[model samples]
Target chain A: MRVLGVDPGLTRCGVGVVEGVPGRPCTLVAYYVVYTDPADELPLRLLHLDTELTRLVAEHRPESVAVERVFSQHNVRTVMGTAQASAVAVLAGARAGLPVQTYTPSEVKAAITGSGQADKAQMMAMVTRLLRLAEPPRPADAADALALAICHIWRGGTRARIAAAADAVRQRTAASRTGARPGAPGRPGPKRQGGTR
Target chain B: MRVLGVDPGLTRCGVGVVEGVPGRPCTLVAYYVVYTDPADELPLRLLHLDTELTRLVAEHRPESVAVERVFSQHNVRTVMGTAQASAVAVLAGARAGLPVQTYTPSEVKAAITGSGQADKAQMMAMVTRLLRLAEPPRPADAADALALAICHIWRGGTRARIAAAADAVRQRTAASRTGARPGAPGRPGPKRQGGTR
Candidate 1:
């Protein structure tokens, strides 16, 4: 599956696309940083971000999008801007009819480097190694975005499969408790006639 | 000027429109709450909000839009959702080519009830009285949205005028420093050359 990962920011939003599945080597399709002037008004900055991201999504056509979730920082202003940038990324993904996922910084680190508390240098080394690039992506944000895409491909797909399996098990348990045959034609619970989730 | 105010939330987003100038009685053009199912996925909820807010802006065609600036809350999850919703609201305004402003909750409260620490009841009462509504708007969020619109109408315009006057003073100072005419054409620094901002 092709995944587009976004490391969202107001001044510089990092975007990277990777193509791969779990347990396989992923290829970096493209990477870029969208820049906006801080001197511009907030709405204008957001408009620029939205326009650039939508353009990138249309060009890349990724199956899924992964965005870095904004965590609380000591600077409320900074956090607010990050959150705004994240919203635009998520909205762009949704607008393109792609499933969007968010990974926290720790989650991305754990998935890419097998450690929740991995530092920036470690992350860059691991990302460089995994993508088989000659060197690390510059500007740190680009590496971080590429790492996020790799993490989603490596770990997010597996997590989703496990969660789906658990859900199926839960459904079976509920059906058994209610004395209904599994996959019955017309019991309650999601008719499954022609509805798409 | 007509203003559309938005009190953004994940579950129930409040939207209201008011018409008036500063130091004048404002009329509530409309007030409502947009609800999203908690069980729905995050992207779908945000999509709904974006669609609805965009529709509201198109139908109302307000001169400006006002959004509640989300402050840091004890609950990180709740604050993130609020911030996301605020982003969508602000984006809607920008997309519609309306100037968007944001005010803190305490600022709205202070503008409406004459105290930053006013209770909900006091805010509701003041909103009702100011808008000439026979009774308080239901669900509190609607009332808060109206109060936000009124606050922007009553304070934001004055604030803008003050800011513009300050800018003019700064420009005059700069011109004096460089020994140029105060309002000379093509003299750098916001030449008033059809730049809307």
Candidate 2:
């Protein structure tokens, strides 16, 4: 499965594409960055993000899109702007029908190394090593995006798929018995549709 | 002398007024908190700030207004929003004809306590003791605003005031030289008529 990792921003968005597989190392297929001019209007910057992300998704055909969760408190002003930028990234992923996942910085650092407080330089080095790229990621944003992708791969997303499959089987068994979704303990189960009538 | 400190934000602004002889001691003259609904459009929020700040200036009649300096990482998404908020606060003070001074968080902390890394609660405690307020400033933002005011009071706002005065003098001289009033800097630097003639 191909994965698209995004480090979202209003001005600069870092994008990385990697070939992901459960229980196997993923390969970094390609990466590119998009920058919105600072002089651009706020809404236009968001539009630029949407347009570029749409192109990236179509071009890379990634099966999943991963983004970093918002952390406000760096600065209130900044946090608000980030909220807008992240919203655009979310919308783009949904439009592309790619499953989207968000990882916190701490979670990504923990996944890359054992420490949650790993600095950007450390995280970048780990990402370079993990992806085995011929060259270290050029810009900080690209390395950050790659780190986000690696985090999702390790953070139980793979197990969630198995759990979802198991849940489907359980639901099928329960429906066969009741002809509908299982009812609460005290309730008389969902009433029989045609047969009761 | 009376000092008014402002913790400016797009959605909320916390203002504190302190009055007394700078060397002898100071008293908490008044304090305020205004919250603008973030859901409002950006321009409306800015207009709201203008009205509320004008009201604060009128009611408190502060001789000086101390504002927080925006210091964030060079992240464009964060800095742009902060710059806008800071600009609004600066204009508010200038419009009121009150000398405006700004200090970074560390500057405030260093002035209050002996350390720059002092936490919010520690700063508030010191501010309460300094102003001899009947109660500790309630909200953290209120405490921060008061701290800024206290910083300016302890260290004469000489640095900022001098800079502003110099800027004013420069502008006036240039305007007289060109025989025209002007606007922001990006516009043609006051005409070159006086120099050529």
Candidate 3:
């Protein structure tokens, strides 16, 4: 699956695209930052960010989008801007008819470095190693975006598998409750359906 | 001036439009709430808000837009959503080429009740009285939105006057520094431009 990850902010928003499935090496498509002037009014800044994000979604055409979930526990001054930026990103993806998911900072760190408490340097190193890039991505925000995309690619696959398994179990349980053989013609017992989730 | 006030939220967004000048009784153009199902995903909720806000701006054609500024000091669990909704509200106004201004809760209260610490009941009372409504607007959110609009109309007028005064002072200062009469020939001595703020 191709995923676009967004590390949202007002001054600088990071976006990265990657393609892969679980247990497979993801290929980097692109990474960039959207910058807004601090001196500008809030509405103008938000509008610019939204315009850029919408354009990027149209250009990249990622199957799904992942955004960094913002928390108020962070810097009180900057948390609101982060949340606003993430909202624009999610809206862009959803408006394009794509599924949007948000991952916490710790989740991204754990997915990239195998530890939720991993330091930035460790996460950067792993991202570089995984993408087979000759050098680390510049402007930590861009690296963070790439990490989020990779994490989503991996975790999304796992979630889909878990959901499919649950569905199968549910079907079997229903068949047993009905006291009919699975897919029986007389009872029209529940049958296994393909995963569409 | 026609002003649109937005009290943004993910579940219920309040909006109101008022028409009047500063120090005059403002006329209520309309007031309503846009609601999104809490069960809906974040992206969908935000998109719905953006759509409704955009449509409202187009329909009302307000000269300016006012939104309640979200603060992180509020309930931590809901602050992020509030910030996101406010962002969408601001974007809607800005996208339509309207000037968008944000007033804090205290600022709105003070403008309405002459006290920053005014309670909700007082605010609703003032809103009903100012608009000459038969009764208080239904849904506290709707009342809050109308209050915000009234505040903007009054405060915005004050702000414009202050800006104009400052501009005049600046022009005089420039004239003295240049050793030329204001608006004189050759020097162009900083003509007194009409307020466009």
Candidate 4:
């Protein structure tokens, strides 16, 4: 399966596409860092990320999208920009009907280097070795994009299965809460209601 | 001026529109809370927010958009969701070509109630008083949204002018860096380059 990975940032959004399946070596298809000028307004920067990401999704047609989940950072401004950029990527993936999963930095590192504490150089070296590129990708962001893709390619399928199972459980629980039969096969489940604020 | 205010949340996004110039009493046009199920996937939740906000902007045709700038919260999950939801609102504003600004909660409070630390009750009371509503808007989120709009109506124009001046300074600095004439009228400035990963 092909996966699109996004390392989101306001000024520089890293995007990479990889083709692979579980237990197979992944091949890099395309890599890009979409940039927006810091001088630009927040809305314009967000729009730039959104338009570029949407274009990438349309061009690559990846089966799934992987985004780096934003965590609290000491620099609140940086984290906020990352989160905003990630939201744009997620929106693009949804528009393209691609399943999107978010992987934490540690998760991506562990999946790639077998250690959550792997340093940037180690991860970059591993990515270069894994993709068998003659030279490492430039601008660290590009390497991160590859790592994110590799991590998702290796772990995302299992994660998705687990999520689907959990969804089933949630549906069943919600059904029971609404007085429906618990686990009755072929029961006409009620339609999911839209949230009303 | 017409302003669209967005109080963004993952489960319930509050939106309100008001029409008036600065220093004039603003009139409420419409308010609604867009909702998305928590059980839905993150991508879907973001998509729902994007679509709803875009529709609201189209329907209201606001002259400007205002979003509550997310701050660091103790609840990481809640903060992340809020950040994501706010991104969608910002994107919608950019797409509509409307000037967008973000107001902090305290700033909104200060603008509406003359106190940065005003309680919700005070803010809501002021919203009702200013909008000349018979009763406070329901679901707290709706009231907060009106407060956001009112805040923008009172404070956003000056902020926009300041931001525009900043943009000009940044442009001049960038041009100087590139050896172009500073503020040369109609100078053929280089196009902003996209990020390279």
Number of the predicted model whose lDDT against the real structure is largest: 3
lDDT of 4 by residue, B1-197 (tens): 88999999989999999987776678999999999999988888998888999999999999889999898753666887898899999999988988899989999999988999999899989999899889999889988988899999888666656677777766776676666565566666675442321
lDDT, model 4, position A12: 90
Which candidate gets the maximum TM-score versus the true structure?
Answer: 3
User: Where does model 4 exceed 4 Å of error?
Assistant: A73-75, A156-197, B73-77, B156-197
* TM-score (C-alpha) between model 4 and the true structure: 0.78
Clashing pairs in 3: none
> What does candidate 3's lDDT look like per residue over B1-197, in tens digits?
99999999889999999998998789999999999998988988999999999999999999999999998788888989999999999999988999999999999999999999999999999999999999999999999999999999999899878887888887777667567554454564455553445
Tens digits of per-residue lDDT for model 2 on B1-197?
78889886655677888876544457888877777776864444545665687788888888878888765554545554444455555555655767787788888899888799998778888988998876799787788888888888877744546666777777777666555534554444553322211
lDDT of 1 by residue, B22-126 (tens): 877789899989998989977899899999999999999998999998887537667878888998999999988889988988999989888999999999988
Error of 2 at B129 (Å): 51
Error of 2 at B69 (Å): 21
Please give the lDDT score for candidate 4: 0.86
Order by DockQ, highest first: 3, 4, 1, 2
TM-score, A chain, model 3: 0.87
Interface RMSD of each: 1.5, 11.7, 0.9, 1.4
Q: Is the docking of candidate 4 incorrect, acceptable, medium or high quality?
A: medium
Which one wins on DockQ? 3
| Candidate 1 lDDT, A34-67, residue by residue in tens | 9999999888999889999999999999989999
CA lDDT scores, all candidates in order = 0.87, 0.71, 0.91, 0.86
